[model samples]
Target: MMISLEYIYRYPIKGFPGERLEDARLNLAEGIVGDRKIGVGSGAMAVNQSGEWTPCQAFQRMTIRPDLTTFQVDRHDHILTLTAPSGRSETIDADTKQVEAGNPTVGDQLPVYRANGNKGYWDHPDAALSIINLSTVDAISQVIGQTIDPLRFRANIYIRAKPWSEFQWLGSQLSLGEAELDVIRPIDRCKTTSVNVKTGVADLNMPALLVRHFGHLYCGVYASVKKSGTIVPGASVKITGKSEDRIIEAAANAITAPALPDWPRPMRVSRTVEEATDIRSIWLEDPLAKTGSLSNFKAGQYIRIHNLAQTHTWRSYTVSAVDGSRLRITVKRDAGVGSQAMHSFNVGDNLTVSGPFGEATLSGKSKAHHFLTAGIGITPTVAKLRYLYAQGFVGKVRVTHVARTASELALWDDVVDAAKRLSGSSLELHLTKNVGDTVGAKLGRPDPSKLAEYAKSDKADVHICGPTTFVNSVMAALGSIDFDEEKIFLDTFSSPSVETEMRPIPASEPIRVTLQKSDITENWTPADGTLLDFAEARGVVISSNCRAGLCKSCSCKILSGSATRLVGEEGNDRRQTLVCSSIPSESIILEV
Candidate 1:
């Protein structure tokens, strides 16, 4: 269904009150002009008025004093006026260093201090703007048996769309008037939404309501303005293709045929070392290393490797180590064809590898870094530790590596040696099957209590890389101990299975599939298999890699019609659908 922007609101002073706007200019770097340029701090909330940014909890919020929501705020250029429910009004210049209020005491005798900054004050560094769907709010109101006001969400933009449809826009670009916004991530609801805007009462429990109905505490979406322009109420909002589709299209148009430096580089395996019984490490060197043509990669990134001689086989492997002009990737023998081929690789073998992608690297700002890994997931951690050692990191660093057995601990010696070279760094090895208490070794998996002990400090960031089950379990354990999920980072080698079993499509009812861009039509039943399989069978070439859905190479825009994604998966959005695991629920039209 088509949706349009219905309302716009901007908060000049965070947690104070919002000002409605007929039209607002969005800036690429600063977001909505004059939006949250100042924040209010109180005695109970400590904030460094002269220093860098801090968390929103360190500032006065509506959750603590819902009375703030009862105040009406209006902004005109540099002048801001706040009118309380008692008809008492106060005017202050927004450019002034301090703002005075009619009632000095807001609630419970809390004195407010104005904290200003050049950049907008936001709950998240990247969340400069927020959008909430009116339909989602209505749906929640129905579930809660009350009329929910959109103002309670405190979003910058409110739009009328299908319930929960805003989530489909994630990783997509939205065009509102002349502005373009890149919807980054879902915004998790907090206690602030519980405050009633008109009555100034902590009435609705939005976070609890969301968690009870949606399995998560997310309500709205966070977006960054990509193009600067004016967005007004009643503007038509249009979403473009999914972000992955645009990325793939750009790469295809920029790079040509046989070989491109950034697309894939030809390399030769210079050395091979057996890390464990089923694990092996291969060192790759650029054939043109002398010319400085080899691409440099980050420490915690991975590369997709393809056998040069066997063009049909390729797989993604985490970079285990880096030296001079050589890159090393550790591989565990698996039943997969790519792993089998990698296991049979010999020195001097030629291979084509691409990318140093992934963002789970060590943050320079983090004083305490925790690395948790299981099985061959330790590969990336090895590169990270090596990088820390080279940088002479003095932070409190803890590494917990788990394996089925001690022999399966790939790169054990390298990790231990790196830990020894870095101050305040320690390595603990765990064997899931064995109960032997070796030095610096544990008998079982990671203990939540021990993890908490290591992470019990400020400025700590947790990096977790492992299989899906292992990572999920560790995340749950951390959550149980009240660890902030935001501080935890994850990189899983496998995507969650879309569905345990594919439902049989009835042959009696064939579904029509139309490639709107290509002007091609095909009929397919459940027996015909997935949309990707049917398209390939018809010689319709669609770029795809990692058919397991971890890589979004096969994502395409669903121009019209509906389709059913694999159970438990979120790819059912009409805007974007992954053809690999999607089945036509009706006559479907696709942009690909």
Candidate 2:
């Protein structure tokens, strides 16, 4: 079902360059262990801005020390000597390298990072955990109307045949099977992507696409380092997270011919809400219908509905009711495709509910204070507020509901009812129609003091669910207050930005993959489709994962003939290719 990585790409330099691998081992047990193990950190990372190396935040950067894919480092002084990929040896002393190579340096002294803190090149896990869904990437691009390189997110794992035609955000936890992960949160993008990963050149508009389509700069999921193990290319993937409903699975599974049993649970409509003229309450049906009671849920948990091909595409709503049999979900019918779709659903719908998911489930796992920023419809915020009130656990809690006018305040009466019902617990609601009060301007952005009013309360656990601007404003406000990152939970609805376009045809010549020892050569003509299709037809077994180059699967080593594919590895002569979708030139020989 996937592509096998015949080779791996290792980048010793953070943004400088990378090396190719004919043989590389995975330490899945250790998260991003060997990946990016050795990065030449200049005091700052500067993408080539306007054709010149620009100074970045931390340090000036270094390429794999001059064409060297594999390196042996000696950091005794502020100097480094590398055996470069070009096979031409050179010494890179901080000050001299920048001046000699004309590579600009932000500061005189740069921090040279070693992989696994080693001065020598060796094995390690991916520097950090990463996963990419080529199909998801494609879907996301379609919405944004741009071509997004999966590598921009820097994922270590790539998935295909996902249940949905859209890029799936975390509806449930994914079990790598071989490893454990503490997924932190979705990454917010930065200006870095504006700069090409390969060329270090800044493309201001590129970053804008991420925001316009992805809702944020980060397209990749950020996972905390947890368990590590061996991960082979072409390994099967299983999604095992709990959900607010099984709607995602239901919609996706409906489209998949031969059902994949491991689809994540779908989020359901809890109780319907008349929070706004365009909003309503949602009632979660069940994660696994009749599998178990729904009482396991804590307050502040959210669920998303997968509206495939319909008006409502996907929307994550907050839960209102606290009970198991029936939890409450609230949503606003914004004039968006996904929002419009959600407004059409009705009661008795066989919606599936998955979680009890999310790190900030307002549970005992986190002993900090809590902050809930409810804006606009405030349905999701009101749900958690009531749940916390019912629990009556002794802790400092603050709730801020912001709306344009009092009439637009959604469910303050219900929120007050929960606060009164809880009695003796710390719960306060702040409202504002202007800048001086509330979370920060009915229209202005959120700031530290304003954000801290909620986030700073007794080491609060902050939960934000709203449009892109609202979530971004809240996060920035909290950052200024130095709010604990672990406690901040954001539910930015996943939106597809780009629409896939017609890519130029791959090389006209057929691709040939030969297994030297086995003497098995697989040929794929454009007419016959991809090499993977050819291999599957002939029963040629080679590991493969993501059909796109996103995953390492189908990466091949060059034996002869210049092949057309993405550039890779130090000293890569352009020989290897991702056979899953790549077509080769005239006559070429490859190890299957």
Candidate 3:
């Protein structure tokens, strides 16, 4: 049966009551035209001072003032009116007011403040719209043993659908009325959901209830407008095919078979050589080059390589050298399985290689280019230099390569040679250790003076890539030199570090993992590296690639409980976790 939109609501001011809408206009860039166009703030956390969006915690919310939900709000053009349950009313003009005078108070104690803006305010910067499933709300109500009001979720659109069916739409396109939206991720539930709309009381613990029932505290889905148009209540909704399958197939074929356009074609390793200490370079060519040559790629692009016969681990490496017949990738040996396996590759070895992807290439519109990198991060810069040398690019170019020691410089000679071939190009090498005039390179890390000199040009495009610390340092140095942030492009191979500390699940205290789609529950312990490993061992097929959590192929919604995502340094605010690196912190339910 087809799902239909049942309700539409818009919050003219964030952290306040929402107004029901009979119809709304969705824009590709801005979600609902007037939804959350302004936000309420108070004291030092005010948004008017900085003119930037602040987190919900900085402002007064329903969690702190449940009475705010009892206020009825309506909007007409630029004027907004608010009416209290006690028959008190206040009207304010949005366009002219910098701050409303003596605004409504919560519990007659805390004063409410408002921040006006034309640009929409949002929780997640990219997600402009949110949707919830009616059946899922009903199911949650049944589990909580209460008649739950869907308005507690504060979603823009409520759709009538099968219970938990909306989770399957992740990464898929949804056609609602004349507008199209791409479901990006599930909306993680917050303390706001605990506030009861009817009684104006924080009575229900929605997050705890969600964890008790689903494993993850998510109640709705966040979407981005793809094709903008008008949408109204009762409009039909259509979800496209499963996006998880497409991601899995693309990743698998990228390493095993040949898929055109999006997927990489199969190639054979023609040669391998140790370029420097702990560094290896491999040349790849189309096995069936007689039929057609390999696909052409612009400079600064990288390819994904995986050995299906060995393991599912895949790693991306920048194309160090490229030609009509073949391409080469330089690798720095690490403790990781992918790098170790790539280091063991011999000539004539069959391996799957996919697509020359990356956007930090030499911009055709740029009149000057500057590259800042360390160690293996210089691989893409080398490719760009080679392209410039071949094309006789006479524009100004500067490259700075930094390494702890001279031995760590993998492609020093190639970069020097390419710089000499380019008429106006220059290369500078820096050594953090081993400083001497005879070393033929600068001493210590990158200096701000060099970046300032390069950034003086209006048409200069700066690219930086390396370890997190190195990248951050270079960015800071660039900023000190007044470099344009918009012109800076970065490519880092490492994922953000996981911020949350997770204690290992005790072997004695087995964690129960329930897979919703398969209706199977498995007991797991610390011995299982991650939930993905445990699930796969039990023949519970889940899509996964880049087991290190860099690739989000294994990301799934946590229906209940919690999972420790061991990816990058950033903490996951979303309810979804990467199953490959996630260990169950408690008895968890996953909608994989």
Candidate 4:
């Protein structure tokens, strides 16, 4: 198979048209000379002039400002010219140092400043080059029934390679012209790609379509320049070497990889911090971080940990924070089996864990967000708030947390820092136990009728995390205020009052259950409580977080027969069943 560079693009100004290049020079630790060196402030982002890297949300981009794609850009000797759809034109005089466009559609004349010096401003701080496979874009075009403009992806390097082959190139070394690159990881696509380059209209949901059709959220690859040199179009591309683990992962991606969450892996507890009298925060570090397994996790997701004494017993806890390959979970000491096991752990101990699972994660698409949490339920909210702070979000963020006391507050300082970092963001604490004891906290529980005051707008994404009663009350109150039910997200991983136990099968022909991936077949009996219990008894590790069936981590596809959900909300796809709560009616084959 022949692979060659097809095109090179340089975005002189972010959110503006890309300038096609005939030839460009590459340097180590820096991308194309002028690429993304300057970006204009918009929304909550202030003008940055210190040549420092800023998050993409800090500047106008096609993701939120699709109208910017309607303009054409050309740079000749520092003078940047842009032409609007109406043929009206504007120019930025780069020689004066700071350049600002006068077009209304382009960031509304937002102040522009050059930053990041030679490194330039990139979506990923360390990733300098974005490489795209033209064939992969064409494949998506075919699936969407429309021609796709690769420029919409805003990638710097475009290559002509086998369709979807670039995904397999991750963790591999690439050679293009005189430059060498370390293909780091697959680029998870976003709504930015949905914009029509010519019309500048977002006519499609690109990320949703990718998940629906391809079963993954990746398209291009982000590479770091290992050995840089000048390169032009038509330069030959070659794979120099492949990492063994990545090769195995590539093979899995060709089959059932995308559907499978990370199975239980033993991570060493590097540190344990006492956040409160009964609450402890444990930080676990993945030994093999090079595989990048822990890096894909999102905020507001939780991990399932196996009970130390009872390996079969698993419990779910929301991840409080993630730093590189290290993830932290804050747990409160309680009579619960999982909580007791977590409290017994110490530094240097290894814990069996799986899944950063849960549907309650942020899209980072919306600007306004409101969080209402109570007691220890602030774990997930803190994680999400930190994400917004890192993105430099300036929009209104309303946080209302109810706690017994300030000392019992998990991540209180972290939440306060987020509130301080985001301008116009508010943080209010409600102390139901002793309100006057805490400095700025209200004395009593919040009135459900007055909950509408917590949100600035009805369109704000409302997140509720707390005890069942608190959650239900807040949810009902938010509903009363006419908040969009669909826009509200909840962390409902609480255990049911009555835990379902494995029951004996009826005195009839035994049910035959097959685990496809495990290649195991077993007969069901009364002793096997549920499909999950049966799989575990057979030495088949079925990835599961909440054994009560809330997180849906142990969900499996039914190839034939039925193992229906016992209770809970129906999943988007009916073909899958939550094995923890599901019982085999007759016989079933599960794609485990």
| Model 2 lDDT tens row, 1-592 | 4422222344444544444434334343344434444334343233232222222222222211211213333333445445433445445553332323222232234444443322112111212444555765676666656776665544456556542321244434454546554443333343344444544444334434543333233344434334455555555555455333443333333321111211233445544656765656666655443443344454555554543332214444556665655666656666677666567776655442223433344664444534445555355566666666556655655555555545455666776676555443344444445434333224533343666665565666776765566667777777787777867776543234332121345545555655454466766566554544444444344454323333234576657654444222212234666665454554566666
lDDT of each: 0.69, 0.46, 0.69, 0.72
- What is candidate 1's lDDT per residue for 146-233, written digit by digit as tens? 9988888899999999776675565578999989888765665655787888888867556545534332346778777778999998
Candidate with top lDDT is 4
- Best of the two (1, 3) by lDDT: 1
List candidate 2 segments past 4 Å from native: 1-8, 31-33, 44-111, 117-127, 161-185, 205-208, 222-232, 240-279, 283-327, 331-336, 343-592
Badly placed stretches (over 4 Å) of model 3 are: 48-51, 101-118, 241-592
Worst lDDT 10-window in candidate 2: 118-127
Q: For model 4, how big is the CA root-mean-square deviation?
A: 22.6
Best by TM-score: 4
State the lDDT of candidate 3 residue by residue for 171-271, as single tens digits.
Answer: 56889999988775566665578788877887755754554344334667877777889999999999864344343333223322122222334567898
Q: Which ten residues in a row have the lowest lDDT in candidate 4?
A: 495-504
**What stretches of model 4 exceed 4 Å from their correct place?**
1-254, 258-261, 435-437, 456-458, 494-592
TM-score of each: 0.42, 0.41, 0.42, 0.46
What is the per-residue lDDT of model 4 for residues 1-592, given as tens digits with 9 covering 90 to 100?
A: 7999999999888778888899988888688888887776654444455667866666777755688888778777988887777777777665455545534646366666676467777776666789999987888788668888888788999999977667556667889899888776567565577788888887775754554444344678877777879889999999998545654354225322333334344578999999987999999986435455666667788876653443234567899888887889999999976788899998988765655766645666776888888888999987898888777776778888898876787788888886788886888888877755666888778776576555634357778888888988987787787767777888855332323332333444578988898888889874575787677655565654434454455789989888645545432234778887777776888898
User: Candidate 1 — which pairs collide?
Assistant: none
State the displacement of the C-alpha of residue 403, model 4, in Å, after optimal TM-score superposition. 1.0
